[model samples]
Target: MSATSRVPALAPFRVRSFRFQWPADLATSWAFEMETLILGWYVLVETRSVLMLTVFASLLYIGTLLSPMFGVMGDRIGHRYVLSAMRAVYAALATTLMTLAFTGALNPVQVLAIAAVMGLVRPSDTGMRIALVGETMPAPQLMGAMSIQRTTQDSARIAGALTGAGLVATLGMGPAYSVVASLYAISVLLTFKTGGSRAAPNPGADTAGVSAGLRTASGERETAEAQPQARFPQTAVAAGDASARPSPWRDLKEGLAYVRTTPHLLAVMCLAFLFNLTAFPLFHGLLPYVVKEIYRTDQTGLGYLVASTAFGALLGAIALSARGGAIRPARMMIVSCVAWYAMLLAFAYTQHLASGIAVLMLVGFTQCLCMITMAAMLLRTTDVHFRGRVMGIRMLAVYGNLPGLLIAGPLIARFGYPITATLYCVIGLAFTLLIAVRWRSHLWRLEAPANTR
Candidate 1:
């Protein structure tokens, strides 16, 4: 059978809203990656300070920590308007920053300020992901949709990094920023094409008027009449259920409570926290340094390194797509995590550029696989109502290692690369083993739902 014929036809891609959402996600990824490379390169070139680089990188993560409040607002109002407004703000901010850079008026303080403001808009990015995915596809096709989303994101990172590097090398940071700003504009346009109504509020809003009416009615009525009413409080309860409910805090709380009680999730989060603290900082800080020092290269080489990892990630996502089952997500996570650490260790120890590049490709593949597994597990385990909030908190936990980024450069500078890199890999390996051992039972739990069978 032909490739297209062998695969079962799932759903028509003619759904206009779904078509728009996919491209919107692609644009968001492209713009985000472009901005990251541009800002990091601009800062390093201008200041030559690793401390400033760390601060610049931390801004987005700091912004991610505030996502839950935005999520709460998304639940209270609607994600449609929130996403649209935020994308507009993001475009405006990028344009302004680009203008300043082009004018040669951009200072370190101004750059950092821009980063912080950009961070504030980061929650909308998360909110859009939740809203778009929910609006675009049915539950049966959601996993495939998510895989596509992840692959596009990784591809964008690769493309953006390469584009940004070439732009910076030829035209300068100003033009790169301009390109990024234009991508954001395209993203906003795509976002506008999605169609969906907002979710209804919870029951609490409806009861306020009924409660007032009861108080007035009770006061006006005689004690004998009120006695029977008081005796039948079930009527009041039924009325309350009809009321416009409070926001989704209870749903958020339920997710939080689950993470607190679920040993498996807790183990995963702990591993994630440590893994992020060590590996993420190394990528943002030391990876650039490695390109500069070990390879005797420039920003373009850094871009190629990033692109290599992204290519590996694309391959890994494709493999996961081929195996369309939800078996042992946690075990997959553990194995990927271990593989990621081993690759990083190899990258750190290798002096040859080709060897380092090969190791980084492995690192990228395993890291993304781990992320996909974790995302799948989290979604399957949590309730639909609470998924957004749980995802929000997960974002917070995963990036909570932001402060450690600050220490990464300083540690490398002080202790030297070999010592620092060895310490990181050792710590990462120990934690991975510990988590795997402790959560072994939970990791293997793959009780298929009746519907899937």
Candidate 2:
């Protein structure tokens, strides 16, 4: 059979709306990843303070913390408009950074301030991904679409790191920032191409029981009874029910309540958060240090290490794409976590450069597998309405632990990198193993039926 014939059709890609939005998603991912690499390098070159680097990392997480509120805003207004506006904000920030660099007056304090401000606007950028999924695709294909999105993100990180490193080497940081800004502008233009730009349901719709259940459940909120309510009750009830007005706190509560109540879902989120807390700091903080210390190399080598990890992530994404559907997500998660820790330990202990590089690739591969499996599990278990808020919470866990990165630098400075890494890896491996054994039955359960409501 031909390669095309061998591949099963993915419903999300066939949809016109999703196809239109794909370019915007790809551009945004590329630009964002490039900005991260450039920003870190810029700050390090200017100040050489690990504390400032931690602060920069913290700003990203702090921005993600505001996503629940951003999600409510997206639900209140149209997601497409919200996405467009955020892209413009990111573009402006990039332009400001470029201008500073051009003036030869860019300082660590100024960079930190800009990064934090940019971070504040980041949640909407992330929320757009979940929103686009709901607006464009059918239920069954959502998992496949998510896999594709993660793959695109991983690919972008790899491409962007290489591109940014080349640009920095040739043209310096000013031109690199300009390239990132231009990409954001392109994303804004692509945002305009998406169809079905309607606001999601508000809280008042929930109390009236007029598609409230549907809104709280999956993407297909339109049940048989929803048609009448959509036509008649929407106007009258919306006019009378001031309580239905969108509230960020209420939305947060709704999401938290779902997490607290759902056993498997909560387990997945908790495991993911702990796993990230232990592992992510190594990537964002320690890996650069490792390149400098062990490889006896410069910033370009750091870029290569990041690129290697991204390449491994790309391989993991391709594997998921080929498999289609949820492929033993929980079991894969546990196994990947164990392997990731082992690789990290190897990276710590290995003295030879070639051995270290091999360990880094394994680390990248296992981390990608663990992350992809966690994402798939979360998406599959969450109902459509709750997906935004649930994802917002997940983002908080995934990104909000900036303090870990902050501490990682100090821990290495005091105890040495190898000992610090070994300590973390051992603890993380033990914790992951414990969680997997304890929650095995709950973690592997399939999604509850729609009619279970």
Candidate 3:
């Protein structure tokens, strides 16, 4: 009704800390997308094995098993510091691989080793980044902030895929690796320059919930300084000093127990895991073969398909962010789940390049809607002290891809791309339908606002 109300919801951008962290995240997202394209193709070129591609993909998530520990680390040391350190580690690993590529010493086994090493450090990035978003923005602005962040990250993903594929096609892997290394370097500089070390406590960290849980369990309040700020005042501190908290293993177990006891949270996590196992690898891990074998295209074509999905995701995310509050989370999730899988199914049957791209765009749009809603729901429900650990649990579930890819490689090789794609889609649909039936009542009522419980 008023001019201020007419302005688009971009409240989270008004936060100074978010602005500084924004570009660094973009650079990091770009680096990740580029690596996915470059490394997947490179491994294929060298080994000519579908199983190898899956192996390479698995290497990326091997470190994710430790995600719960890293989540606890973030709760202790602050996500900003954790994120900066992880980026630096990424840079170092990228540099090592880059040097190997430039020197003509790179091979599949060596790449696999590097990938395994990278996996160790990579798990922290997702859990920390998601938790950091909750940390930096107030609870009220979180959904919008997350949507905008996802939109930007998707844009970078498009850029990174295109850039990685183009560079590898035209200039070669050496130059592509160089660019990846460069992006990491810039991200590191941006990370520290923005003063990550001094950033304030995360307002969305669920400090009150964890504090109360601890008090109830232990039958006493923590020391005044060890206590969390229970209210949403801007000046609130962290739940407590990390040292006063339980051990990391204990925290991880407690996080697991919390998810187990929380039905909606547990349901959402199981769906996420199933989606990763069935839908994600089909879209990303098997695309190159789909391009070459089915579409009769080259590396450039593979890049095009990947980029199209990202472009679609960017559009979908932007629309969701801009059209804020017009849709309900529960219905959107159901529609997105159905649409995303249906598009993927259609894409598998199509022979034309245009049709493939169209289906991918739809898939991207719907999948983004599903994922963003799921994330917003999880963030809204969890407490600040437990945020990292909870996200860690979620991340571990996402590593469902680790096994999915490993098993899929052989299946795709044995049955061919079309059959493999069909099977995955069927599996995904069955899981989605199960969730819709079993969790329908709860999920339908689930809202994305803070403290929905």
lDDT of 1: 0.67
- Order of quality (TM-score): 3, 2, 1
Q: What are the models' TM-scores?
A: 0.82, 0.84, 0.88
TM-score of 1: 0.82
TM-score, structure 3 vs. true: 0.88
lDDT of 2: 0.69
Every candidate's lDDT: 0.67, 0.69, 0.76
What is candidate 2's lDDT per residue for 308-370, written digit by digit as tens? 777777777777766746466777777788898888887788775567666677787888788
Higher-TM-score candidate among 2 and 3? Answer: 3
User: By how many angstroms RMSD does model 2 differ from the true structure?
Assistant: 5.8
What are the per-model numbers of colliding residue pairs?
8, 2, 5
C-alpha positional error of residue 427 in candidate 1 after TM-score superposition, expressed in Å: 1.7
Off by over 4 Å in 3: 1-6, 193-244, 446-453
Which residue pairs collide, candidate 1? 202-245, 203-244, 203-245, 204-245, 204-246, 205-244, 206-243, 206-244
After superposition, the stretches of candidate 1 with alpha carbons farther than 4 Å from their true spots are 1-16, 123-131, 134-136, 195-244, 247-254, 448-453
Q: Give the worst 10-residue stretch by lDDT in candidate 3.
A: 228-237
Candidate 2 residue 54 C-alpha distance from true site, Å:
2.1
lDDT of 3 at 325: 60
Clashing pairs in 3: 135-202, 205-383, 205-384, 206-383, 206-384
For candidate 3, write residues 1-453 as lDDT tens digits. Answer: 643356656666667777777788899989998988888888888888777888888888888788887887777667778789989999999999899989988888988898899888785686777788877777666677778878767888788888888998888877899999999998888776543333344443333334434333566644324533432211143444434455566556667766775666777888888888888888887787677778988778887788889889888788878764666665677678888888888888888777888889888998999887777767776766567778888888768888888888888778876777788889889888888788766677654332242
> What is the C-alpha lDDT profile of model 1 across 1-453, one tens digit per residue?
544345633231444566677787788788888788878877777788766777888776777666665555554445555676778888999999889978999887888898889877774475457545654455554445556667878899899889988988899768888888998898888878776642232221112112222222244622213442332222334456423343355434434555665566567678768876877666644567778767778888888888888888888877776664653567778888888888888877777667777877888899888877776555555434444555666666546457667777788778767677778888889988987787766675554221120
